[model samples]
Target: MEGLVDINRLASGEAGRALLERVFQDDSERFLRRLRDRVDRVGIDLPAIEVRYQGLSVQVDAFVGSRALPTLWNSATNFLQFD
Candidate 1:
């Protein structure tokens, strides 16, 4: 819970799984709030903002999706190596 949490280790336990979920939820909310503030400060119209938000969301989804496969592969390989 302090520094450098290993996702594979965290996923292995109930408490760690809950903590990971909470962390991700909090991070996502924080990111949206910051994005909203930035758009407001820039005086973007609602329609334009929505477009930008959609673009940002797609990028984030793609980025996270891209990394997930590699992370899972590495985790499995690591577990196999250790086991």
Candidate 2:
């Protein structure tokens, strides 16, 4: 959350996952703010990134989508849902 947080550029899904965990842990409030801002900008009707992140997980299971936390970890493919 300091410079740029492009999940796409990460070495792997595990790396991405670890980075996310770090960001979320460092400043959950700020992270949530950014997520909320992103969702707002994207014009998602759901209005909650936590929900989307939670529901989209196959490998990276989400514990509490509203809380913005990752659960299970499999791989980047499953993590990002590239298929």
| lDDT of candidate 1 over 21-82, digit per residue (tens) | 99999999999999999999998877633333443533322334544466877668656765
When summed lDDT is taken over every stretch of 10 residues in candidate 1, the lowest stretch is 55-64
Deviation of model 2 at 57, angstroms: 39
TM-score of each: 0.50, 0.26
lDDT of 2 by residue, 1-83 (tens): 68985666773688787977887688988888899899899988873355335556457545344335333553443557646
lDDT of residue 32 for candidate 1: 97
lDDT of 1 at 76: 83
Model 2 alpha-carbon drift over 4 Å, by segment:
1-26, 47-83
